[model samples]
Each structure stands twice: as structure tokens, then as C-alpha cells.
Target: MKRISLFLLVIASLFSTKTVFSQLILGPDTLCIGNELQLSTTVTNASTYYWGFCSAYLKNLPAGSSIAAGTGLAGPSSIAMAKDGNHYFVYVVNATAPRNVIRYEFGTSLSNVPLATDLGNFAGSIPVNPKGFELVNTGGNWYGFLTGGATSITSDIIRFDFGNSLSNTPTIVDLGGLVLNPQDLYVFKEANNWYALTNNGFSGNLIRLEFGNSLTNTTPNVVDLGNPGSLSDPSGMWPVFDGTDWHLFLVNRGTDRLTRLDFGTSLLNPAVDNDLGNPSGLLNQPRDISVIRDCGSYYGYITNENSNTMTLLTFNGAVTALPIASDLGNFAGFNGPRYLTRFLRDKDNVFAYTTNNADNSISRLEYNTCSNAAPPISTLQTPPPVTYATPGLYNVYFASDEGLPTMQVDCKLIRVLPHPIIEVNNDTLICQGDTILLVANGPGLFSNLWDPVYNTIAPYDTTSIFIYPKEDYRYNVHLEFTQGGGCAYDTSVFVRVSRITADAGEDRL
Candidate 1:
């Protein structure tokens, strides 16, 4: 059972990178979480106003040019980078031993370092001990989602269907256990089904796997969203939907800090949830985390693995606009950097790659621009605090430091409005007192504003509650189990309901 991601209460490590972009600075690309935006940029010799950060690049071998040495890469844990057209693929996974699954190919530039191809052993054919990997490319095929097991993490989800060449050779079918040593897995797609979100790290908890639209051999359905707060090793990938709630951004590594889990999009009694902690004592054990939008903003890259270094989070919308430490002795790459992936090397450049279990090498980070020296921070005409707590997309530029400045840099990709998922469900925390919660799944309805019967022991309504006044009342429940411990039945399907606004509305249970 020794698998806190295979021994890492510390000593994990990072690097394997790259970097982009511009924009005028008007404001309002989109915002809905904690909404606010204001700024002006029309040029004027540009004295100083730099609120932009692609965070420079090029560590170019030098600690004696250190930590960038691995021909076959050894313990590298998690990583997934894709792009079939101009070729650029990376996939790592090796929690030690012959637990293979490595591949690296480059062309058209990611600074080209490539060298390591061995995608075999399919994580020991479910002997469970891989870590994480996800490539996916839907319908037309091309898939791969790996997350080593602790036993049936919901039908042992370790699928792979390379129908269109991800180098083919996949056929593993794991989706069994629900969570205990899980580790990582982030495949996503809601409504049309096909889900996955794993991160147990020995039960710091957080699991979900539905796989309806295929994970190859299909056979899943487990939603054990346990451990709602104060998670120390908690780890389960990422999620963001801010029109009203579906948050989930995580990374704890026994608590280096960084978290979120609103649960507002409903997963049938996914029960009362909300973590929201984000502390950054500088992060040291952070195993994996990634996001990119470069230059205009929306950046987050963490992999401290006991401080091998790599932590840059500048996302002012879903809040986080401070922590930026990428000098890894002088630009980046210290080694042991766990997992990372970021693309977009054109239209403004941005290339971040990582997977370094202490020297399995690979950390090319090149986010372009921003190196006036030391801090390089500048911003005055007031335009920096635009809030957001949950929602995505943000690319805010203000740059204009006048060293050779022109004021032609542009950026504004803000789109943040994801609360309209059928009005909202606040993550089914419908509790009352002494414990009670209901959201009977899809086409919902368990009551309107309360007291429509949700247990005090009875209201397990013997089926039949279909109202339709102002049009659209639902009762589509696919249910959640409970009976020997008290009422909470299921099996009802009627579609078209609307009236969700209680995330445990005044909880007392």
C-alpha cells in the first residue's frame, strides 16, 4: 500500500518547459465570478504599466547545465501533450520499475530535445502503479486515459483506443476500484457522458468515473466525491465552470496548498462541497498542475516536487495573480518536475513541457517576454484587480515599460460565464437537519424550495410528483442509494425541470 504517488511526502521534483502573446488593454472579454474589469491603453511613449507576464524563458542547461539529463527517462510520473498535425507528442508514466509508457517526438520546434520512445507494458496490464496520462481526441477515435489502480477505481479505468494513431498499441481496460491510492486522471466531457476525475493519494479522497460514451471496453459508474475539505494529499486533476459552479481545481501534496471544489454542476447528491483554499507558502511538494493562455493572462504551472522549482500562477479571474517564481537558478529546469503540458507556440508563442522525476529530463518552458530584471512589475493608471472565483479564460495585457516600447502589444480573451447549466444545481448539497440531501439526477426534482419530502424518514414518495405551472417542471432522477439507513429512493424519468438555487440553502444538517 505504499503509494502516496509512490513515496513522495517530499522529494518528487520538475522542469521540462517553453512560453507568448499581446493585446491593447481595454478590458471585458468576459467575467462572471466576482466580476470587474477596467483599463485603457492607447499608447503615449509608455512610461510604465506592465501587468503582463509570459514569464520569460531559456534556462539552457547550466547548473553545470544541470538536471536535464535522461535518455530514457526513469521515474517520470504524469504528462500528456498532443498535436498530430505538425507533430509534437509527449506521454510519460513510470512510477518506477518496468512500468513503461514513454514517448517523445518533436518537429517544427518545441526547441527540439526529443528522445525517448517505449510506450509498452501498459502500466503492467493493470497490476496498478502507473500514475496518470490522458490524450483523447473523441469520435474519430484516438484515445488514452491511464490512472493506475488500487482496485476498481470505478471499474479500473485504464483504457486506450488508438484508432487514429497515437502510436496505436493500446488495449488495457481498467476502471474498477473507486479510490484509495488512485493518483491522477482528468478526462472530461459532461452531459453527453464520458467522465473521469481521479485523485485518491491514499484516500485524501475525490473520485468520479462514469464512462458512458466509451473508454474503450466500457464498464464504469462510481461517484464517491468524499473528503470535502482540509485535504492534505488530496489530488484529483482539474475542473472549472463558472457560470455558477463546477470548480474543482486541486493540488495538495500533503498540503503545499492550492484547492477548489465547488460541485455546482450536480452529480446526483454529489453532496455538499466547497474547498477554496489556494494558499502558496511557495509550494514544495506540488506534484502536478497546468493551464495556459500566455501573455494576456491565465497561466498556472506548478511542480515543486520538494522545491526543484517551477511555480507560476497568474490568473486574475479565477483569482491568483501573485506567485511567479521561475528562475530555477536562472530561467528554469531544476529537475524532478512531475507533470505538465502547455501548447500554442504560434500566434504569440507558448510552450511548456514537463515530466522530470529528478532527471528523467524534459522542462523546456518558453512563455516569451517579460524580463526587465528581477521583478519587472509595472502598472499605474489603475487596472489590475479584476475578480473571479470560478469560471475560465483570462488574458489580460497592459505591458508598456519603455525600453524600446511601442504600445502595440495586445490581449483580451476573457470569456467567463458558465453558470447557465440549466439554471444551476449548486452541487446537490440539499441537506436540512440530521442529514438529508436529494437531486435525483438528470431532469431534476425532489422539491421546490423545501419540505416537499426529503427525509425526516418519510417522503420517499411512492412515485408520482409531476407538476407543470409556468411550464417546465421535472423529476428525471436516476438516483442515489439509501434505504436501510433511511429513505432516498429512485427510478423516475420525466425531463424539463428548473428551480435550482440551493447549495444547501441555509444548512443545519
Candidate 2:
């Protein structure tokens, strides 16, 4: 009987080893929209190797470096970026005097200067300061929500309807009052219900607002989530869903420690605080944090107020108490870094920014995501590139080691971007020796190249150019957006020159 049991255990061990060793690797998980994926796998020479993209697995944390984001920002506290079908808008709260919200609009890509527009103060003017802010886009419309902090008395949360543009006078609604000062607020949607969660710094209670199915719901179901975990001065928090359950990791400014809470599946339910004692890098008052999940791991960047530094904490899963902390050190401090935000433009392109409240400047961290990349391709020959007309998230999948029961499989999500349409003049008849302007105009910025250089005007490379043509010319223009991921388009124009004939009917006499 002992020999039989040992044989079974040995066989089970071998199978486990096979499952781990044959596990396929298809990575650089995050991709810029419209970029062609050069996919291939390591298990080569198999009868067949198949692959695609869908839900994926990630292993390690990516590395990043910090710098200050440009100038012209004043007392900016919280920042959030939302993508409309055609463009991206960044909203920042000017938490100081003459308090108002600043919008930075970028088109197609984040390569150029963004247009900054100040959308007046909260309704009834600015009384109390603006707290945690978030922007969410549902259907085709954009919505901006700002939390009001308590000064001498309780304040109400406000919502703004941006329609399609954040520039117009927003339709604002005061969402009622709370007893304590509100801290960091987060807004998200699940199923048909839209929800916003905000915790008060003074009351130590987490508040939730349910907007139901409508983005414009004025009367939200407000609930005071009395602090469940002895959470003192609750401030910065980040949530993650690991296939089955939803977990929240937040910092308690009052206790100078870290706490984890299990919210079962939905964040709507009350979260049971799971305390994770103090780690070394938490520093003095950990104010705000942002979390990113890929390959089954969570990477969170936290801002410590008193020490004026940033710390990088990682976890194996959402509910784990063992958070590995690494103090990224201070970024030329004394400039109290208050809140932090991150934008993963794509794999190989990641950036995080911290709003320095003291000096009124923003510090940016650029991460290197290109290390240990092994993208798997099923078909030995890479498939011809695909062009997605509209922009959104898409599923990709791949399979390998065909004809075997233990074939390897992997999947991930891919984003598609909109096409950059080149606007120019149509076929036209021009008088001989006359000059005409050729223009390719659009929003954002682009690189334009005009072919048939002969007879073309000076300033050959630009969005709009003048042409002094002596002959009928067919000009083809190739355009590429300053937006990365190889987003490009081409179009052409023909110019007909009408010349007056000064010759006899027959050959010259």
C-alpha cells in the first residue's frame, strides 16, 4: 500500500511540473491602440502553435523614473484623465484661491501641448475647497464629479454634465451634505449601476453614492459607510479584482499604517477591514495612491505627505497582507507631493504624475516596460496588419502545441484607435503660373509628407504649403499622427493647369 501511494504522488508531481513548464508566455500585455502585434511563441517546432488575446497573466513590476511635468499649474490637488471616442481630456482641481477646475485637452495622442481651460468653481461659487475628483465617460457623453471639503461646516458633493465638451457651461447639481470633511473620492460603474465612493477624513466614515443606471441621475442613494476597520483618518486607497473577489488597499493617515479590506465581489457592499500592520516605506501621512494590475499582480504607487517622498508597494494578489514595500525616495522634496495618478499609454509606455501641493508643480514618473518581453505568435508567419476603424478595447487569443491534450493557451486585451482623416483640397483647375495652397488640416498634430517634389513650393514639409506649379501635377500626401503606435493615413490631390496656346495650327514656320 505504501509503494502504491508513493507511485501516485510521483505521477502527480510530474504532471504539476509539466503544467508549469509548458505554460505559454505571450506578453508586453498592454499595447497602444492600432499597433500591429508581432506575435510568436517559445514552444517552436511543434506540429502547430496557436495564439490570440483575452484575459492575461503578468509576473513582475515595471521600473519608472520621475521628473516635473511643465509649468502653469497652481495648487493642483487631484487629477484624472478620461477618453472621449475621439479625444482625451485631463481634469485637475485648482484647490487654492479662486478655486476652479482646469481641463487639459489632448487629441488622438499625448505627444503635444494640451489646451488648458478653466471651468469655473463649484456651484454657488467656491466656499469649501474641492476634494477628490474623478471623470467618467459613458456612451458618448463625459461626466465630471468633484467632492467638496468641509471648512467650518459640512459640504455637499457636486456633479457636472459635460455633454460632449468640457468647455460649455456645465449643468451642475449639489448632491446633498455630509457631516464630515471628505477625502479621496473614486467613481466607477458595474453592471447597469454607477457608483461613487468617498471617505471623510474627519468622521472616519466611507460614503457611497449610487447613481443607478443613468449617468445624469441627480438623486443618488447616499450611504454613510461607518468605518468598519478602526480606519483612522482614511485617505489614499486603491481597489483591485482578482478574477473572483474585490479587495481594497488604503492608508490610514491617523494610524500611520496600511489596511486591506475584502469587499466580496462588488464594491457596493460594506468592506471588512483586514489590517496589514505598518511597513517601513509608508512614511508620515500617506495621502493618495493609484493601482495597476497585470499578470495577476498589483503594483501601487503611494505618496507620503510628511516625508515628501513616493513609495512602491507590490502584492501577489489583492487580498494579501504581505505587501513588499520599496521606498522610491524623495523627488527633490519640501514640495509636499499630495496626490498621485498613472496613465499606461501602452506596454513600453507608462507614466505616473504626483501633484505637488506646496510648490504648485507636478512630478512625473516614466516607467520602462520593455524588459523581458516574449510575445507569442501562433502562425510562424506574422499575420498581415489589421486596421480598426473605431476605438475601444478588444480581445486577443493564442494556442500552442497542437494535437496534445496539454496544449498551452494565452490571451490578452488590445485597444483600437480611430483613423486620422487628412483634409485637403480636391481636384481643381488652376491658371498657368498661378499659386495655390495645399492643406491637410485636423485636430491634434501630425507629420505630413507631400510626394512629387518637382515644381512644388518652398516650405515643402508642413501641414499647409503653397505650390507654384508650371505643369499639371498629381500630389499624393502621406500623413502620420504624432500619436504613437504607428497610427498613419494617406490621401492625394490633383491640380490641372490651364495654359493659353500661342502657337500656329501647324509646326513652327
Candidate 3:
């Protein structure tokens, strides 16, 4: 009897240990198209890491199956998908001396028994301790900026000219002091020039560098977007253009919060769009942010380093001033997730990938909250095959797994061309010697443009005019519809002028 009890106790202890160690970690995956989904994860601990591919869409990830991309990876840091969508170049960094990169053909493994053409040593001649890097193509030339240096002097941004083929042999030009202790780098286009933006972790300020044509031998403008809070160690910056202006979203690791800056006329002076203050919920060590605009709504994904989780938020361009973040629950196997990026286009669905530093794995997630959820409560009945009938505005709420409250997403509907019906006082007969008031009305019309200029209030105002004529004439008024719809509608009325005769006395007549 005692032996039986001892065995049961041992089994219970093992179960408890497994539960404590298990975690929810998410990772980023490279995009591979064609029905099946493929992903590559870099496990830093093991020299031989597996690159896995899932066989189902993101929503079916919980039940999907994945296979190894290959073995023999030295813990890669970042991946840059080729413009062709057929090749992927990965930055592999291990505890070794120099950081390295390998190019993998689509649907091929890095550890194919007989490897073909190894693109070796990603960190060629660029000092140690690599942070983050971005590659961009401009005017037929591929350029890359790598952020790395010594611990205290890690503010150097290395520029690599990969030529036409993006060869591993790069012409290096070190642009030092672009940002004080830069952590991550992002590249974007404005007007005719290209700009590089970085987060200075040490100085707690967001910096921007502009370069045209060539990053080498050219002096770039450096602008400092001062951090509002005290310990705002800014990490990641993402920007989106909303017709009129650019909205820049930033993640501050020191402050543990998300803030936005708006650039009206210039990137120099930025106004705070939304300041959630310090100690925002579940933002512990927020590292990277990415935005996916789907179905007239912007979905923002953020990775938190300390919490080992990812958060989702919604930003409606027309409605809200700032984005409302919702905890979309945690990825089951992710640990210390770092980078978040949107994967290949899947119609209206949002599929995202993240990279986990703690476990060195990649995760795929599907967000159907805004796309799949039922349209908010509406009174109007939708026509056949249509979900919502009303064409105004709607709202959606997302609940995050973390302590963050439910976030709302706003949606709007605008009809392209609405057939407007015009109504005017029918064929009126008036004496030309006297002035008369004529009014035109059209429901659901935006503006009106009338022909034959008469006494009017405004040229584009609702048609209300007064006219007088000396002879019998036809009065025509051309009706113009608002909302930039189709053609114009016209109607005419007749006015007859009469001669008034006065008879004094009939005797001499």
C-alpha cells in the first residue's frame, strides 16, 4: 500500500513541474505562398535549429501541422524577404565572433544535405553586438542599414551596398552617431527622398536621418523627436500615411507604453496624437510594432519582450484620434517575442508572424475579430448577401488576454455614386415685367449648380433664384448634383411678357 501511494506522489510532482515550465511564446515567420503555410524559426540555444512550415491558415494554426525548414542555423536575428517572393535572406547571429546571413530558396531548407551557394558572414566587417537592420531598394539599387557596435558606443549605423544581386559582399559605409545608441532601424519614403528612422535607447529620443541617391558620402539630416516622459526608451517606430498626413506610432520600453506622433508639414515638429501616460497595461518591455490595414480598419500588433506576449489594437482612420489596443490572448508557445510583421495577403483576413527570442521560435496568428465578427447592432435590414444595411458608421470591440481593457474599432461606409432625384416647381407661367421666386429641391444631394446666372446667394448653393425678363422667353435652369455623382439634370419654365395699356378717354381714340 505504501509503495502505491509513493508512485502516485511522484506522478503528481512531475505534472506540476510541467505546468510551471510551460509558457506562451510567439515568433515571426517568413512568407511562403501556395495553399500551405511555411515558417522558419531561429532557436538560439541549439546550434541546429528547425525551420517549420504550417499546413493550414493562421486561424487554423492551433490544429495545423508544421515541418522543419532545415537544420544548422546559428540563431538568426532577422529575415528580409526578396522582392521576387521566391527567396529569403536571413541574418544569423550566434555567440560566435561575426554575425552571419544565409540565403534560402523558397521551399528549401538551410541544411539541405548538399547546400547550394552559402551566402556567408552577414556581419562582414561590421563590429559585434548586432541590434536590428532593414533592407530597402531604391532606383534599382539595394541598400541595407545594420545597427550594431560595442555596448557603450553602439550608435553606429552601417550602410551596405548590395549592388543589383544583393550579394553578400557589400560595400560598407559606416554612418556613426546617427542616433545615440540605436536599437532598431526602419526605412520609409517621403516625397522624392528616402529617410531612415531609429530609436535611441540610451538617450530616450526618436531620431531620423534622410539620404538621397546614396547613403555614402552624403550628409543626412538628423532630427530629434524629444521624448515626452522621463524614461521613454523608445524601441520601435512604425508610420502610416492617412491621405493628408503621416501618423507615426512608437513603442517606448522604458516607459512601458505606446505613444503616437503626428507630422503635419514637416517631420521636425511633431505633435503628440495620443499619450496613454506611463505604466500602460501589459506593455512591459514593448519592442516592435507593425500595422495591417484591412477592410477600412488598421490593426496594430505589438510585441512585448518582458511579458512574452503580443497585443492587438485597432485604428480607424476617420473616427478616432488614437488606436485602442486589445489583448488578443497570448501565443501558446512563445517566449520573449521580439518582432511582429504581417504575412502574405489572405483576402480580408489578417495573418501575422512574430519572432520569439526566449525560445527562438516563430508563431503565426490569425485575427478575425474585425473581419469575422457580426456587424454591430443595427436597426436597418441588410439586403441579400449583405451583412449590414446602414451606410453610416459602426463600432467593434476587441478583448485582449492581458490586463488591457477591451478596445474599439470604428468602421464607415461611403457609397461611390448615389442616384439623386431632383424636384422643382413644375412649369410655372409668370409675367416678365415682375420678378418671381423659384426654388429647386433635391433630397440626398450634396451641392447644386444652376445655369443662367440670376440673383443668387452662392454659385454652388441650393437653387433658389429670382429673375425678370422683358420679352416672352423660356427660363432654363440646369441642375447639378452633389457628391461628385454622375451627369447633371435640367428643367425649364416659360414666362410671357404682356404690354399693359391704359385707356384715358375714348372720345379722341
Candidate 4:
């Protein structure tokens, strides 16, 4: 009886060890919307490995039904998944060796085609293995970063700028004091300036760096958010510049929340405050963040590390918990998804990339069919009418909703002309028969006509007119011009004439 009990205990111990060794962990997922998602993974000691997507909101996924697969290494390491055109790129570290290998797959499924590239040697001279890597583009140049390793001699950040040659060697940019063992790196531009954010040593303190036109000149700025330590630590950090401001969001590992930092007002003196107050609560180790501009709103996604769930946050500062962590209705399984990225196919289409650390696979989420709703449109106003008698140029104005999520429309200006008026020197005045001169003046008109009984004189387009007042008689003058949408109208003025006595011939009126 004693021997049987000892055998049962031994079998239980072996089973527990196998279970622990077979577990998988993933992180730093890359997204190229509507096209593909690249996920990285690290598995414990195991002879063989398999990967697939499971319904994030479902219970069970069948075995051998995964998006992709790769052989595992001995310990913890970092990998990168990205898309070049239609093909997906998977960069992995060899478990048994220091060499890193690149594999190519189609869509989200594993491929049997023998298409792989070796990146030659590590980009940096440091002997420590890399913890996070990214493919970056700056000022029309293709560059990348291999960050965080064991060696103090290795650069914290290394840049790869492949100029003109597919096989060209990458140039390394050493960020001396800007970063330290950066676990994750994100780069974005605001107001024509390039900026980067990196997670430093699981301390929950993020380092900010700015790049000059030349890649070598990098300046470092640090923003310390209180640390939560290793158990619930910060992982992926994403930064976005919305023309006016820079928004930085990170995964809060301790409280399972998505914390937002607004740097829109003062880029130089950024005041780090929480944009969303700890909304995503009780999440199992959130990893990556992806944001999309939709209908004048911003949508955010947070990928989970242990549970099959994702947290969604709206730009209105509202957070909604989503259970679509797995493939929609597809029986593939998601074990430990660590990172997420978003892509925009067009103005109307969008997609997301999720990396499952446990499954060593990737999942693609797409929003293809959009509703045909009218985009936000508005009319601009020119200068409003005022009761001014004088004629001069006035400043016109226009206003509407400026910040909508669509193509901008051109503005048009419309002008409105006011009517003209004319006045005579006097209503009644006596003048001698000796050819008294009469004068008329007012706002200028396009055309003016003066009629004397049966004939018309001074038919000119001018502001003033002069005529001889004959014996006590009345005369009429007319002015005409186009007004309001090319319509023509005429205004008339009346003048009274008087006969003067012979003694009044020398009198002035």
C-alpha cells in the first residue's frame, strides 16, 4: 500500500511540471490594418509547438487549428511580427542559438512555403538579447529598433535605416541617455516634430525622446507615472499626435486599466494627468493599445495577457469592456494575447492586429462594411450686413465644425452690393436767366441720366452732374445699376427750377 501511494504522488508531480512547461507567453504585437497582424511569443521548454486563434468570447477551441506556428526556445525572449505589402514578416530568435531568423507567412495562417531571411547579425554590439523590436519609418526613411538586453555595453536603442537597397545594411543610432532597457517603443510626429516613448525597466516610468532631422541627434525627456512593479507592470506604450496635441496611452498592469496622458497644450512642459480615470478594471494584465479616429471620435483597444478579453475606450472618455478577444465564431483559440495594432484601409474601412503569446499566433479583426451616413457638413458665413453709410472694404467671416473625420471641403465667398443714393444742392432757389449752373452729387452710380423736358443730357456714369437751370421749371434725373443676383433697378431724383427777375440776375443761389 505504501508503494502505490508513492507512485501516485510521483505521477501527479510529473503532470504538473508538464503543464507548466507547455504554457506560452506573447507580447509586442504589430498591426497593419485590413492586411495582417504580427504577434510574438515565448514558450517554456517543449520539443514541439502549435499556435491558433480561439474565440475570445467563446469557451473551447479545437487542437491543431491555429493561425501559425514556430519552434520554441529555452527562455524568455522577444519577437516581432509586421506586414510588408501583402506578405507577413515574423522575426524570431532561435532557442538553441543566438541567431535570429525571419519567416514569411500568408494572411493569418501558417505556411509550408520555405520563405525565410536571416538578418545576418544582431544590429547592436551588446551581448544581451533584445526584449522588444519594431519596424519604424521617419522622414521617408525605413528604420527599426532592437531594444533591451543583458549587456551594459549594448545601446538602449538601435536604428536601422535601409537606404535604396533591399540588402542594405542598417545604421545604428545610440540613444545614450534618452532610454534605458526600453521594453517597448513607439514613435509619432506632432507639429512637424518627431517624438518617441519607451517603457523603462518595469518601473512604470516612461521615457520620452525627440529626434532631430539627423537620426543621430536624439534628446531625452522623462515622464514618471508612479510605478506598480513587476506583477501588474506596464508593457506597451502608444503615442499619437492629433495636429494640436500629443496623446500618450499605456497599459496599467497593476490595476488592469488604460491610462491616458495628454500633452496637447505644452509639448515642452507636458503635464501628465490621467485622461480616463482607471476605467478598465479587473482586466488580466493588459498589454498593447491601438486607437482609431471614427466619426469625430477616437476608439481605443486594450489587449489582455491572461484572460480572453479586450477593453475598449471611446474618445468621449468612456470605456466599454469587449469580449471579442478570439476569432469571431472561428474555433481557433487565444491563450495569452499581449499586443495590438490598428490600420486604416481607407476613410471608411479599418482593421486590428492582435498577438497571442500563448498560442504563438496572430488574429486579424476587420470592419469592412460601413453605413452610408452623411458626413458632417456646414455652411460658412461671410460678413453680415451693417447700417454704415460710407462705402469701404469690410472683413468677411465664416464658421463651421472644423474637426470632422473626413476630407476637407473648399469654401466659397459671395458678395452683396448695396443701393446708391444721389442729392441736389437745394430744393428751391431763385436764379437769374443768365444761365445759372446746377450741381448734383451723392454716392456714385453705374449710370446717370438727366432729362430736360423732351431731351436728355449729361448721360454719363459718374458721381456728380452739372446742368443749366432754365426758367422756373422742374427736372428729373435717373440712376440705374445691377443689384443682388444681377437684377437691374432705377432710382430717380427730382429738382425744382425757378425764374429770377432781371434785378436778381446778379444774385447768387
Give the Cα-based TM-score of candidate 3 against the true structure.
0.53
lDDT of candidates 1 onward, in order: 0.51, 0.59, 0.47, 0.41
After superposing candidate 2 on the true structure, give the runs of residues whose Cα lies further than 4 Å from its correct spot: 1-72, 111-113, 122-127, 151-154, 165-169, 317-321, 331-334, 369-509
**1-509 in candidate 4: lDDT tens per residue?**
00000111111211110111221223211111111112223423333222221101101121223344444322213445443333344444332245343333434322333244545445433225454555544443555555654334443565555553223455556555345546666654446555556666545566566664444455544555334222135566655545456655667665666666666544445436563444535356666666544322346566666665666554553222222222223323445655554332211223344545555565545543212111111121221112222222211111122222111211111122444345554555555343333445555444555554322235444444444455445555544433221212333434444553566545343
Best by TM-score: 2
What is the per-residue lDDT of model 2 for residues 330-449, given as tens digits with 9 covering 90 to 100? Answer: 743426777665443321334455667787765655543221123422255233343333365544444454325444544455554555555788888776766778887666545778
Regions of model 3 farther than 4 Å from truth: 1-69, 85-97, 107-118, 122-127, 150-152, 166-171, 216-221, 228-231, 265-273, 278-280, 316-320, 346-351, 365-509
Clash tally, candidates in order: 57, 19, 17, 14
Query: lDDT by residue for model 1 over 51-101, one digit each (tens)?
Result: 542223322221212333345566766677765544666677666677677
Question: Relative to the unseen true structure, what is the C-alpha lDDT of residue 331 in candidate 3, on a scale of 0 to 100?
Answer: 53
Q: Over the stretch 1-509, how does candidate 3's per-residue lDDT look in tens digits?
A: 00000111211211110112111112211111111111111212222211111111222222111113244334444433332222333333321344554444433221122222334564465545455566665555666666765355654677768775454556777777566677666675556566766767777676678776444544788887666444376666666555455666778887788777777645545555566543237677887776544334456667787877667666655413456566655654556666544232221233344555555444555433232213322221111111322222212211111111121121122221233466776655444346665667677544555565543334435566665556666656665443232224567666565555433333210
Q: Which is the winner by lDDT between candidate 2 and candidate 3?
A: 2
What's each prediction's TM-score?
0.27, 0.60, 0.53, 0.47
Ranking by lDDT: 2, 1, 3, 4
